[model samples]
Structure formats: structure tokens, C-alpha cells
Target: MGEHSKALEYYEKSIKIKEISLPLAHPDLATFCSCIGGVYSKMGEYSKALEYYEKSLKIREKSRPSTPPDLATLYNNVGQLYGKMEEYSKALPFLEEALGIFGKSLPSTHINIKIVMNAIDRVKEKL
Candidate 1:
């Protein structure tokens, strides 16, 4: 679990396999990219994390419906990554977008909506 490099290796291998078997725009490919982004984020490689996250976000944007929850999750991931990188100004808009989508799609009191709202508040405080 603490083996970040090992985790990354496996993630990359899985992505390669999925890429060969799945369509370019497949949601599974997006998810694979997002998983890699998360691993990079946990390793504190913020730039790499952002790159993979942007890849996932772009794929999801093209493949998923406009208001899919996965899109909100990717936005939240990018926002949190920016926040962790101390780029709060950049984080706020992404977090706010996640908050808006969660608000529209989830119950008012849903935990995800609450989490996104709290993240937005934290980013705003940093601004």
C-alpha cells in the first residue's frame, strides 16, 4: 500500500492493456487515467497528477454525458490537486464547478455535495 512506485507500475500496465482492448474514448480508459492521476497525487507529483487528470477529464468530457457524476469527481480531483499544490486561485473554479454539478445531481445533503462545498470553502479561504 505504501509502495507508490509499484502502484504506479501496475497502474500503467493496466492502462496499457486497457488501451489495447478498449476504444480511445472508453470510460474505462478515462478511469484508468484517473487512477494513475490519483497515484501520482498520493506520491506528491502534482504536475504528473494534473497531466493524467486532465487526460481523464478530457476523455470523460468527450465520452460521458454532460452532467455525469464521474465528471464532477474528476473536477474535484483536479481542484484538490491544485489546492494541495498551493494554487488556490486555480483550485477554486474547478472545485466550484464540482460543487455546482454535485448540487445539481446529488441530494442537497449528499456527502459528496457536502465534501465539494467544503473543498470550495477551503479553497476560497486560501484565496
Candidate 2:
């Protein structure tokens, strides 16, 4: 089940299926890459995680409409990874980018956007 240990495997399977069936640079594939990247991050393979995340970002940039939610989510993921690695300076840019995206996509009163903004502020303060 998805809630169990097979979650990552399922995500990978889905990604592979999408990659074969979908067009190049499809948003679904990009989302799959992001999911895989998150899994890699959880597994403590930061480099691999980053590689997937970057790949996802590229696909989103090329294929998706420039929606704030999408860019912000990707940036937040990259920023969080860098934050985990103690690369605060590198993290700041990504977090800032995410914040900018949120600013455009969601209203200021939106809970998730505000939460992301708070996180960016906290990280910036630490940096």
C-alpha cells in the first residue's frame, strides 16, 4: 500500500510508466521526479535527490505554465535539501524563489503560503 514501505516502489513504478507513455517533459513525469527526489531525500541520498529535483524543475520550466504553486514547490524542496546539508546560502535563493512564487500564486492569507514564508524568514534569519 502507498502508506507502507512500498510507497517508494509504487512512486517509481508510476514514474516509469508515465515516462514511457507520456510525452517528453510532461508535467506528470516532472511530478514523478519530484516524488522520487523526496524519497531519495528521505533515504539520506542527498545528491541523488538533488539530481532528480533539478530534473523535475527543468521539465516544469519547459513544459508547465508558470504557476506559482509549481515553481514554489520545487524551489521549496531544493531549499529544504540545501538546508538539510547546512548550505544556508544556497538554500536562501531557492527558498526566496519559492516565497516569490507563493506570493504570486496564493493569497497572503493562505495557510501554506504563510507557512512557507515563515520558513523562508527563519532560514534567512539563520543565514
Off by over 4 Å in 2: 1-5
Reference-based TM-score, model 1: 0.95
* Whole-model alpha-carbon lDDT for candidate 2: 0.84
Q: Residue 75 in model 1: shift from native, Å?
A: 0.3
**lDDT score at residue 89, model 1, on the 0-100 scale:** 92
Q: Taking the tens digit of each residue's C-alpha lDDT, what string does model 1 give over 69-124? A: 88999999999999999999999989988988988888999998989888988888
Top candidate (TM-score)? 1
Quote each prediction's TM-score. Answer: 0.95, 0.86
How well is each residue in 1-127 modelled by candidate 2, as lDDT tens digits?
Answer: 2353476789888888898899978988888899989888888889989999999999998896776597789999999898888888988888888878888888889876776777777788878
- CA lDDT of every candidate: 0.92, 0.84
Clashing residue pairs found in predicted model 1: none
The positional error of residue 45 in candidate 1, measured at the CA in angstroms, is 0.7
